[model samples]
Target: MNGPAQLADLLGMASVQRAGVALLVGSVGLPVIGVVIVGLDIIPVRFAMMHVALLGAAIGMLTGLDPALCGLVACAVAGAGISPLARTPESLSGAMGLLMSLAIAAALLVLSIAGVNASAAFSLLWGSILAVRVQDVLVLAALAVVVPALFWWRRRDLALLLHDRELALVSGVPVRRLTLVLLVLVAVAVAGGIRLTGALLVDALTLLPALAARRLGHSLTAIICWAIGIGITVNLIGFLVALALDLPPGPVLVLAAGAAALAAHLIPERRNTSWHASVH
Candidate 1:
């Protein structure tokens, strides 16, 4: 069959449809969350949550429970536990490092004790979009709505907080409480992204687009719009290209996002340099 036919057949499968919806939701939601994450300089928290999710998945495998649910709960707990430490960049970094180490070690211990197959463990790390369940799609869909709604509702506070936490606090923005809420939201979102794209490449949907959009946009709102637009574009292209090439979508998606970020970074520099030379 031709590539389009093959893609159509794949899309016809219920599982693939679920996977596509999950990705679509993620493409929209993750970037909005990424704005807060990038603004607050809390990138380490996402990495820590990824490891916690893996530990949760390991425990689920041992206990015969749904790994996705276990992972989500684990991430939420970790996010809450670490919220107090988010008072400063240094504390947050140190706490995240400690959490990552502990989570990964615990995950290894659980896997070894249970004699879980390496492939099963590896699945949590690499993810398989084709294996996405309906529940996963629903969770992503809900988050897609809730996160953007929260951002819209709290736009003023978030804007102030992102600009400068101390300034936000001075303006009576309830920095600590808002930070805690954002962290929890980020944790849950990261877990959902992991379910679709795996721990290692969730950033393709989350961070990379935000980073690329930053290059293209000057204001917070503009950056967010660009991030969402970039995320949707890359995700769709990557999914279709993966279908065409008979490849895994996760890595291809990452590559596409990375390429977009690279172009976003370099193109502006080249344009500026050309402009400078012409002026000189």
Candidate 2:
């Protein structure tokens, strides 16, 4: 058939509908968390949580439990456990590096010992958007709403915290508790993203949009708004394009996000170069 007819038929599938819902929620939510991550300079935590999620998925597969639940739990625990080290960027990086190594090593061991099928393990690595379920959509939807609401409610405090930890503490921002809470939230968000897009490409939904938004926006609220807008645009375009081309949505989405981010970065530089030449 025709391209539009083929896409319509694909969209008619329940699995595709569920995947679309999950993607929609992710496109809206992950970027908000990304702002906090980037502001806190906790980028490494995302990589560490991804590995932890993989390990959790491995154990879940070995024991016949829900991999997503296991991964979320693992991430929460890791988040709380590592929160104490978040006082400094250097310490956070070191701790996250150690956690990433341990998590990957343990995941490999579990997969090897259980002799899990390569496809099963690969699913954890790359995700299967078409296989997303109703429960997954509900979980993602709830997180999408709750995370943004929390960020909005705490916007002022978070702004202070992002500005300076010492100033936030002096301003009674509950730095320790806030840091712990944010880390756990970040962990849960990462786990959710991984369930939909996999570890390798979760950043497409989370970081890239926020990074692009950062380049375009001068304030936290502006950054978040820009990120959400970019996220929705890229995700919808990528999902539809993938459907049209019979390609995997996850990688296509990543490429779309990357292209947007690259454009966001380069366009301003080009403008600045042109202005400089005009001035000279």
Candidate 3:
């Protein structure tokens, strides 16, 4: 087959592959949003969650539980634990650092005791997008729907919290509750992305698009929409390219996102008179 034909054939893959691609698209959307507004705090949390995921996978292997589910639950629990600590800058850094270290050490210990292969224990570092199951797709679809809807419905409040939590609380915005909700959603998004892009590359789906969008958008809402668009575009392109080239999807997807970010950075910034007004 020629290049176009080969690409078409790749796109016209089996039902499972199609579902996996769809799952990737759905799984990536919300985390990119988190990356956009939640700021640098999310970076450490992402790292912590990855370590927690490894521990969860090791434990799952030992217990004969589904590793993916176990990893998701563990990440969610870590998010819950980190949420309160994340309220302040000092505590946030300390918490994520502590958790990341502890989780990785525990995971290594568990893997050793369980006699799990090191490569298998670290499988989440590479991911297997083409192997996603129908059940995983269903979960991704629900998350795709629910997360965006929640963000949309609570856009104003979320905006307030993102802008300044102290101000939001003073304005009676239930800061702690909202922060917890956001953290939980982040956990879910990170865990799902890990399954498709792996723990190491989840930022391709979450962070790069947000960074690219930051270059183009004058306001948070605009950035969010652009981030979601960029994320979905990069995901589809990356998946297709990986399929055609018979390469690892995780790294390919990350590189694609990086390319987009670089391209965005190359565009000269234009001053918008209305930016401040709109953002406020």
Stretches > 4 Å off in candidate 2: 109-119, 269-280
TM-score of each: 0.90, 0.89, 0.87
State each candidate's clash count. Answer: 0, 0, 0
Per-residue lDDT for 11-61 in model 2, tens only? 998888889889998888888888878888888877899889888888898
Query: Model 3 segments beyond 4 Å from truth?
Result: 36-40, 270-280
Model 2: pairs clashing at backbone N, Cα or C within 3 Å: none
* Cα-based lDDT for every prediction: 0.83, 0.82, 0.73
Per-residue accuracy of model 1 over 108-138 as CA lDDT, tens digit each = 9999998988468657766778888888888
Q: Which window of ten consecutive residues has the lowest lDDT sum in model 2? A: 271-280
Residue 118 shift from truth in candidate 2, angstroms: 7.0
Best by TM-score: 1
Candidate 3 lDDT, 204-265, residue by residue in tens: 87778888887887766676778888888887887777767878777888899899989999
Between prediction 1 and prediction 2, the one with superior lDDT is 1
TM-score of predicted model 3?
A: 0.87
Q: In candidate 1, residue 76 scores what lDDT?
A: 88
